[model samples]
Target: MTSEEPGDSSVVRRDRFSGGPARGFLSSLAADERIFEADLAVDRAHVVMLAERGIVDGETAGAILAALDDVEAAGHGALPDGEDVHEAVESAVIARVGPDGGRMHTARSRNDEVAACIRYRLREDALSVVEATLALREALAETAAAHVETTMPGYTHLQPAQPTTVAHHLLSYEAAVARDTARLLDAYGRINRSPLGAAAFAGTPFDVDRERTAELLGFEGVLGNSMDASSARDFLAETLSALATHAVTLSGLAEDLVVFSNRGYVDLSDDYSSTSSIMPQKKNPDTLELVRACAGDAVGDLAALLTTLKGLPRAYNRDLQRAHRHAFDAADVVGEATAVAAGAVRTATWNEGALAAAAGEGFSTATGVADLLAMAGVPFRTAHEIVAAAAPDVEDGDDPATVAAKLDAAAEGVLGENLRTHVNRDDLEAALDPARSAESRDSAGGPASPAVAAQLDAAADRIDADAEALTAGRDALAAAADRLETEVDRRV
Candidate 1:
């Protein structure tokens, strides 16, 4: 071991080494700044656990804990020159309380300590993303409720295929967001597990209470296998996977709104849109465009994380330090995208009159007429043929009577009888109306008004349950922090 300076009180004993370009290249202080508080909490918890287990004397534990508090109060700028935040913090503590401060690292390695810090901070980050997902879900469901009767043309292959209400379309996205929220909560289960006692990838010889540290850190439980706990990054990969899928869902929704805005079916709120730099008449959906682009960014982050973790043979490697950066990028990007999408959905205005007018264009109600004919004793295939025959004669402004006359002529040639003989004009006219056509679809999970209302109610209940779950998780963490702090105060 070598000391860096002669007669320097703050010099830390370490193996002989040269510090130059390689030190700056390997330093993680920039990224580790995000988890500085988490590192301090882990130190306090570990020291308290050591004292309770008789692994360290009360006097040393108290001095170390007090020094940790001082180190934290000094802020990031006061951290010493080191390869990572863990070393910097430990160096600060030793500088403050002399050799007694070094006792704080008893029964733990930087491997387990850094892993615990990542998990502690990631739990809060995952919860925040879940909260944002819930907000978007609430916005979608409420918007659907308000538009239950707002009729519009539903598209397939970007062509008008049938009539559907705005509520039904909006509710589709709400259902997707509900599933996204569920996936994130499921991923949290793995993220909340603690890896505190897996010191240097093997069981510690010291009598350490892993569960005590886990409880103090608000973890659901300790990761059972020491080696796996020290090196496992699957939890981070799973979180990024969930976030990436959610970003895809948001991208699809953004694309739909962009298409709708382009087609004059809906108008976006000005705040979510932007004006082109050179074009005077352009109102671009720039926020949604960015949300759409976030899918690629999130996917890239997940891929990068997996690539970094792949082919690693062991319990702990320096490469693991690079993994958390990708996770942080994914979480931050998706969280912001989710918030912007919620705002866009909440403030958007639908052009109800324009939607109603366009709902019947391109022979969109032809399927309703065929179904009506099928219900009135006409063979479904024969009804299809009859409608196909009359489609050429149907004009944009043709009235129901004119359309009925064409259907009759086509039926006479196809079935040897007029369509009016089987179905009266009143029935044909009702089937030809797009609004009635949409209402006629009363099947379960259909786009009818009543069906959409039921869906909205169910989505609202799910949102409430998820919101409560998030609150409970957050409160549990807060209680654990309070308990840990209280224990620290009593010991020190």
Candidate 2:
């Protein structure tokens, strides 16, 4: 080992130095400024709580608050020359108050402080994720509304099965996104509880006002126990899980868009597609593919986080720090990817002719035939058997009108009721194609023009409500931040 220099802390070990090609540290680059901001919030509350509890002098608490306000004004708190976030903060306080800033840290440990910081950051980021989710929902809703009556082939087993409205298909994703939004909200609720009082794996001897700190910082409540607070990374893990789930959901939608954009099914907007560099004629749905790829990244992050935390026997460990990058990176990936998907949906185009043609080629109205037979008073199962036996003989590629005619004449003596009245034989043969059939279904959630219109109206209302809620939540957080800053200033 090299001799220790006058100011050197330790000799650099050659074994560790040459262990492998050293990667430059970007760990600190992932430092969530929101987390640092949260730390400031916690500090403001902590000083006030200390003063109220008589653990620290009024002047010391007051000075600490003022120093914090100054730190905020400067856009950073007391970070140290060679330390991490916690030490940096305390160092700033001492610089401002001539050693009194050091007292504010008395009852707390870095463990609890770090936990609170993460919670605050998670709360802030979760809201954005929710907003992105809502935006995606609205985009799908808009697409659904515009294409409600536009007919498309509904597939089962990758084969055209029936005619369904494009609006109906789009609404299916809206329903999915709504659930994702709810999941995020649930995750936010869990994230709201504060861990500030946990104090490094055990309760502190000091009579700390953890509840007061929690309230001052706008946390829902103090964590029930100290050890659990310091040791629990569940909040971080849970937030990532929510993000992963949303990513998976978005990926599913992206897959559909990719398939739809291929080979004349749906014409994706030029902005969302790209020409292959080598292929002379290729409009690749590269953007959609990216969204799908991002979902895989989100999933990997989720698994990586869980793996990082799984075997650690911990109140706190350096290894736990590794979890931060995945969480932060996944959040960014999800936010940006969701935004891209929303924009694509807003600008995408569909091929009405292609969709209608595809819908008609595979006896798309077979189910409707069964539906009509049931309506004519034959029990559905019997009607199904009768239709099933007659179906193969119904002529391949026959349109709904021809099928209706064959059914009507075949069942003339058996099932009673002018089937022709309910189904147009002549017009159904010529103009009443699958595209029109999709327009005719008007039941709730159906692809009928009127039903699709109703769905669009409902989706609009839901989108407005979700957007308002998100705005209000953000405003509340901002207000809390402002109030905390102001209160600290008053004390200083």
Candidate 3:
């Protein structure tokens, strides 16, 4: 029995972790690199607050800030090597400024650090998602304006239900995206609190200024409870849930685009659509399909975070670090997918004749027929069934008047002359025409030309308001990041 040499034992241990005797360390795949710039901005604010409050001497604080700046300047702050980002940062600071650089962790723990970084990232990414949503809203508004008078068939249960202007259909999506933007903005409000200075699962003994850190970090305030700050992932879940919802909404619109782009229906321009590689006759709506398919990844991202947090312990766990990859992936997926979807809407062409032909189908005017019978004192159900029976086997191109005339002659024998006083065949013919039916719906938000015009105008105003708000928010974030850099440079 002989003891192994120290070098030999080290070699064995390295192989155990590496699964090979002499392979180079596995290079990080960089699957889900976080928004490190935002995290560094937060770190800068935390250091500045420590100096201002005298928690660390001004020189040490200045050195740490300078090291951080240097790291950022060298290819945007390469993440330090450790179990996680907080450890990586602390290791870097210590390497740069001796033991005093380690003092920055005196009152903070990786638990609090992780929470703070996530919050900072959430706040930044939430605003970017909102901006992307505003772009989609703007494109929808533009589409609505271009097609305000282009009639199309609206459906219920995928069956033609009524005649609606194409603008009306487009504006429906704009309204949906506007609501999605508002939801992301609301989530940002909830994520705007600072989690720094919480220190693990409890308050620190040192007299640290959380409010000052919050101000420097551009957070509205310190999180109210230390324990909650360390353990809560609700903000991340909620923000990503909102993103997933937006993705789902866009996927639905994309599905509609895919269907509309097919030769079986509307003929979309070749610029916005692609042809199949192996089949010359096949024009594939690949862009819209991509938009539709990308939604599943966003949804999977939300589910992954939720599953990771489902049974976690009170304080932070190593598993929490693993959560970053999916959250980061989700934001990038959302941003890119949303931009693609918006571009498709802006550039795609619509065939107005196809839309008009779809609208003119007599089946789409059944509701108008029901309205007509109700106007003539027939009970609504009775009117519906009556029209349903007489509804010109439109498959055969039978006119509504011709169908109504046969029904009128039959009723002449069944209900005597009383039916003649209530029903006019000519009136029925006018009621069953889709163009007149669309024009008759002059109510607000209806498919009537004027109604759709007003909706387009309102959507434009909302798009501008949303875009301006997003711009103001982004400018503020940029300024905060700039201020941190400026302050760090000043001290250095």
User: Which candidate number has the best lDDT?
Assistant: 1
> Any residue pairs clashing in model 1, and if so which?
none
Candidate 2 residues 370-456, lDDT tens each?
Answer: 666577566788666655655665765665556766666655535554556454555435333676667666788788887777878
lDDT of each: 0.89, 0.75, 0.74
- Please identify model 2 stretches exceeding 4 Å from their true place: 1-34, 66-83, 95-98, 311-314, 389-432, 439-443
lDDT of 3 by residue, 1-492 (tens): 113222222221332553353322331213213645665676788788778878888888888888777656763236443334454555556666766666767678767876888888878788888888888888888887888778888887777789887788889999898888988888888888888888888889988898877777777788889988887888888888888999999899988888777534455456667887798998787877888987899899999999999999887776776676676677788888888888888887778887877875647787786787688887888766665655555442556666566556544554454345786767777776777788889889898888887888788888788778778877776777777777778788
Off by over 4 Å in 1: 1-13, 17-20
Give the lowest summed-lDDT range of ten residues in model 2: 5-14
TM-score of each: 0.94, 0.84, 0.89
Clashing pairs in 2: 78-88, 78-92, 79-88, 80-88, 441-448
Ranking by TM-score: 1, 3, 2
Q: What value does the lDDT take at residue 64 in candidate 1?
A: 86
Candidate 3, which ten residues in sequence have the lowest lDDT sum? 1-10
| Candidate 2 global CA lDDT score | 0.75
Task: For model 2, state the Cα shift of residue 274 in Å.
Answer: 1.9
Residues 383-475, model 1: lDDT tens digits: 999999998888767888888899899999999998987888888998899899999998978888878878988998999999999999999
lDDT of 2 at 357: 70
